[model samples]
Target: MSDFNSKHEKVAAKLRNEITGTEYEPGDQLPSEKRLCDYFKVSRVTVRHALQTLENERLIYRKQGLGAFVADTTLNSGLVQLTDFSEDMKKAGLKSSSGLISLDKVEPIKEVNEILQLRPDMKLIRIDRIRFANGNPVAFDITWLPPGYGQLLFDEDLTTQTIYDVLEDKYEIPIQGGSYRITAKNADDYIAKHLGIAPESAVLEIDRCSRTTGNKKVYFQKRYYNPSHVSYVLELSRNDNESMSSKDGLPLKEFSPSFAK
Candidate 1:
């Protein structure tokens, strides 16, 4: 490798470590290239390469002429990526856990029934969990699945693994695709109790449904997040003919299809 390439690699590794260590908070502006050059005593090429490396890793994002900033924890879930909570946490260098509250077979609720298109007489597997990031509770999740799928899940340990892992690896059911909707919700007594947040607090809620490649519904999930600790992001690409743009300083189509939260 060339000397410049080696320097860039070193610089990138340095920044990557700092970002993972939380030296910079999410959305915080990073030092400018000029400043980075002065600090590292490197050339502009090296600094630019380092910034690009971080951007590519999604640890930082650049705004043209404005410089780069630490990327938010908000998951910018790609439309097609089927990622689970543990995988998402691993990428961010954090340990994840699920506090399994309950796993029972019960009559389907209205929401789960409609989302999963389940027959009224069929029972649903109701699993409740508190998802943690770095050992801190981030989301209170309740998921309902079809009996066949849910039964397969009972053999696995939910506390130590994500359902996605159990389904795909154990049952050989891959979560090929999914859709989600994000909306704000008030924390009720139940949510507050599990999430350890104040009742009536504002929380970000996501309703997600996943299916197999064959179009069979796999799971219907309701997740509530403490907005301060967790966030969501969406990345969009413009076609060759269309210019990229945002609405009112916010990105258009504010949805991350994957359950990155």
Candidate 2:
């Protein structure tokens, strides 16, 4: 049993190397099972097993009658690691800062009251800013926090710090987890004006409600990202127990931009 697993693993590793190391470019088909079998001196079953492993990793896709082809894994970014904008820029070796747009106490902006479970009279501290990387605008952030938690936004220098950082580090309100949804949206006039794109252009909207260590819901935001500057990605696994309630199954690519060219 061990040897059987080991045989396919060797084949899977070599194929993975080729797929990722520029040997097989995106959309390029792999050699046929018979060809792979002859090359590796392995059986057809072993080659199929190897191919299955790559399919699971999203490195390749198989067509029923055609063959396996490399998946285009470029221009996509992962949301697997939940990090504040500052840490995200640090990872990419770029300087990150915020340009404040507006900050003030306000009547609950759309859905802010429900997301935070606030009372009808409780005002929300709305902080609006354009997030920058190396001084280039990448995303527009509109965040709402209850007064007790949102106070950090005023305490810290947002020009050099992030709300998430201040909340977790200073206020000790580490975001333990969050619920998020991603959807493609046409850049509304408000979003386009801030992002400096044409009205009705394409944008990625990431809406999230985050909770603290005590499972207290306190943070809510509408983050509009320029897809050309940032793309949202999530790595999924069949083995993962987490499943979205579905009428049928799951999906992401609902619509693609129709380029007029």
Of candidate 2, the 10-residue stretch with the lowest lDDT total is 252-261
Candidate 1 segments whose C-alpha is farther than 4 A from its true place: 1-80, 242-261
> What digit string (tens of lDDT, one per residue) describes model 1 on residues 83-187?
677877786677889999999999868768878888877889999999998778888998999998889888788999788767654544546568878899999
lDDT against the true structure, per candidate, is: 0.77, 0.74
Estimate TM-scores for all models. 0.62, 0.59
- Alpha-carbon deviation at 41 in model 2, angstroms: 59
lDDT of the structure predicted as candidate 2: 0.74
* Residue pairs with backbone atoms closer than 3 Å in model 1 (clashes): none
Which candidate comes out best when scored by lDDT? 1
Q: For residues 112-162, could you state the per-residue lDDT of candidate 2 as single tens digits?
A: 787788886788998889988777788898889999888767756787767
Sum up the clashes in candidate 2: 0
Supply the global lDDT for candidate 1: 0.77
| Clash statistics: count for each candidate | 0, 0
